[model samples]
Target: MAAQGQAAAGSASESGGSPAASAAAAAAAAFPATSLYVGDLHESVQDAQLFDVFSQVGGVVSVRVCRDINSRKSLGYAYVNYNNTSDAARALELLNFTPINGKPIRIMYSNRDPSSRKSGAGNIFIKNLDKSIDNKALYDTFCAFGNILSCKIATDPSGESRGYGFVQFEMDESAQSAIDKLNGMLINDKKVYVGPFVRKQDRENVSNNIKFSNVYVKNLSDTVTDDELKEMFGKYGTITSAVVMRDSDGNSRCFGFVNFENADAAAQAVQELNGKIFNDKELYVGRAQKKSEREMELKEKFEKNIQEVAEKFQNTNLYLKNLDDNIDDEKLREIFAEYGNITSCKVMRDSYGVSRGSGFVSFKSAEDANRALTEMNGKMVGSKPLYVALAQRKDDRKAKLQVNIFLHGSWIYTTCAFMLFHNSECLVFACMVGEKSGEFY
Candidate 1:
């Protein structure tokens, strides 16, 4: 695997010896020489189906549908191995975008070294594209330049094109030629912008230099009027407009906006007035952002806080099921008290105050939680054995359940299909035997 090669190489470099370097070199040499990575496969496509489709062009030595180990559900990608490099190349040429299970599969040579991809050596970004363009159309448009490693169009959740895309070529010359010829060309009646791809962090750093003319201010004294707000900020900037936000009842909301005549003036006002006391309250000032931008910022902050909390309690929380009907919060606490310091324990109940036969327990330390889990799991309490494990977030539990259901359904469908085929074969054999023996009525 790529990870193994990287680890081995790192070890070799750290040890400064030929043995480790030779081992790393051997590992890199032995990996996936004739293997093709097949991506964008449908979840239901398995190894057998891939082999049947790919074997027409070459001798397939192996096919593997990558899957999640826990649920055994397809991960939407696979690997196909051929006996020789020529066969592998043929398969890649003939079946790059072959449709299976109503979805197209993308094929590429399996590259164990990830540096070429990560370095963004020959990647280009295309924007302002027509919404009609997709992956295949983009590929067709650019393939004349050189060998493309990958091409993709950004799309929304509903699968609508987002008017932008990325393409990475195998060689920098190809990428440069494409950009030079097509950077401002009209495609589908839209003039597109094509350039070398810039990473998100770099783009963000560049955006920090952009100018703005509108400023937001909060923590104003309730009695401050629009004129007073203007007077307070007029010292640093030429105010084009100033307004104190008011409620339906016409009372000040203690926040307002100021639009300066120039971006530099607004920036200066913000720099000087922010965090300064204005009418006994510390003023907060910043560039005014659109509602969507504010919402996105808040959402990111909320998710970060949630992740921190989850990490803080990661190994110290336990979920319990098959609880006895007689168990209550106090009894749950009593059961886990011997393991370690019990922070919180609760047995869930319905509105009618009846036991739900499930509970949660929190410990002050991971060791205590692990000890409790080892001792209590599958242990008989009253009429059933308890199920205990580390608690998962609601979203994670839901996703696991969905994967399990999908796998179970696929298994049932496959079993039924095999049964039907077997029955038809048996009927044909019985009819032939009867005809040959002259026993048919």
Candidate 2:
């Protein structure tokens, strides 16, 4: 019963089953007949019920109502393979709209479309996910268009489910086809929105700019990846690298930056992707600058503030204080020079040129000087701690805390006794009063 030898090369594409009504419409148009996969059959319907209703005007070879692989419950869809093209044509024409068991019967040819036919137009997106839908499901759903290297469904901690996911196919044609056909299709009653996956900026950055050599893109769909981005942008330029950033927790951020090997290529990518719609979102694109540049730029703003303060304190003349006896102004300036411009550093010395244990560090800007003061104050250099408090007048501090007391005759007692004890480095102070020689002495 094998048609192997009799079957020509094109015969496989041409089903041996006859058209139930007519193949003129399909064959004339050169359109291959695809099976009208039926679903939601009433539970008690049988093969006879289906055949009687469908085979009235068409060639009939076999009607196969597939059931669960193990449990064998009616899967609701039946495969009707007709013997002659005419018979198959008749069945579809006659019964596609016929009602059986309160559900209209649809009769189309059966086919298992391989990866070659993803070019048709449709769209796909998935939802109502139980969080268990895995990468294989994602790939299998879209891979029919072409080769798919990998796929993934986002999951939660404790490995639960994130209710979302991404799929990557080797061919853009396949991805496009999936987007077109499945975008609004109802699978499990959930209307899925399918489109190209956009990756996070960070992952894309790592792939192209940080870890790889290419343009980075942000505001990507969480599902976008290295390969897909390459394919999407590959037309624009020779992409040296591509990546979609993933959170440490393993989820894609919404956007990513793309770095092209040359500015020209990156410009091309931005031009092509900007305002372009993928997965229903307009893509954001640009060159990714290194993260450290922002820090340096912001820190420079404070430099002026430091110099302003320093000018008021020293009038541009270095007044060094608290200089370590062993270290001099030359050493002090050298240490602070890395912060910014240093006009001068001169340690104060007494008449004998002895170190005053205090020194001045003069930065060109009050900003830098104050930064040093704030950051370096109280910082210990070797065994000694450096004090960076405002340079106050020496005499002002000495005059602030003076106290005065006047003793009068009424303030004195006749006699007084006091006792103190010391034990193992512990000091104790105590007082007692007693009449010593005269009244209350």
Candidate 3:
């Protein structure tokens, strides 16, 4: 909401000299036919005050200040019915800023049915209100800026204020003026938040658009509670809710969700807390992804992993045995560089920091590797002959291992029954096909 200055001419009737005449002049420009909406009255200023004030202009018919059904307290606004249309018009002109019990009230033409009014025409939403501040208190607090049409404080089933309300002014300028002066102002030691009133559906759509503000956290300590989680993430911004998941036994499931007031706070919490240790275990925090999204991402990663492994076997990679214990990755690359553009080279190392006496060298092309294998096979390196051959894939290595196991009688079986009895585990079932038929390759 924004503020606007009231025109000086509008307040000329408040100066007192022949107020009724000045009101009649102002009414010519903006006047109602019969009823006037009076707002900003103190909780004690009842229908009597409204009737007494408007009666000064002309004949008065009825005055009703809306109130709670159970408590029967003033809702801070009322409707005044005047006998003559011109009398109602003059009431708005002169009584626009008339004081009632030390508070200046706003008066405007009555548009009683909200359904007939334009949506959000001059409305503002107010929240963080003190629980004790009823409709009258809210109205009296905001009435001085401009004429108000209707003011309402949301209440619960028990007729208690829900700490929020709505204020609608006759003119947008007046609504803006009130917001500018009263928004964030302290009332009853609590600062209230004021903003433009949006329709519920529009608010829901906006919330959906920024739903990333809610974060999912896992690996929480068993002792962690909702309040603790809120305190941890509240530094970033206001938190809407925080909950730690639990089991049937009331034990922590090691997971939780934290919803912030805005996306920026959620993003910050994710960046700073993801993978950070919490209660002796690393916690995972991130935007809560749907189950379908997680499954799709895992599938893509699996496909990518298979592609990478396949790429290793397709390149000009060569396996070498009898690699010197002292040969490191850089030395192996240097030795193979003369054999036509080596793409990569690495000597396998054991846990004790010694080479496994084997290494792999990948060249830019298969032709280069074939030539290098021909030239380097049986060549002396560190007093031992180098054994050069095409590198075998992980699956191919498994196939060879199965052949060696079958030859050594480790997988001996006379019939399919015996194989099934032993529950034989084969890494490459296809490679064993030829072995069972007396053919070994």
Top lDDT hit: 1
For candidate 3, lDDT tens digit of each residue in 265-334? 8988888988898779888787876544444444444444443443444436678899878888898888
The CA lDDT at 125 in model 1 is: 97
Model 3 segments more than 4 A misplaced: 1-31, 36-81, 89-108, 112-118, 211-441
Cα-based lDDT for every prediction: 0.70, 0.50, 0.67
Model 2 residue runs over 4 Å out of place are 1-24, 28-44, 117-441
* Alpha-carbon deviation at 281 in model 1, angstroms: 3.2
Clash pairs, model 3 backbone: none
The candidate maximizing TM-score is 1
Model 1 poorest ten-residue lDDT run: 414-423
Task: Report lDDT (Cα) of residue 277, candidate 1.
Answer: 97
Provide the TM-score for each candidate, comma-separated: 0.48, 0.26, 0.33
Candidate rank order under TM-score? 1, 3, 2
lDDT of 3 at 142: 58
Give the lDDT ranking, best first: 1, 3, 2
How many steric clashes does model 2 contain?
93
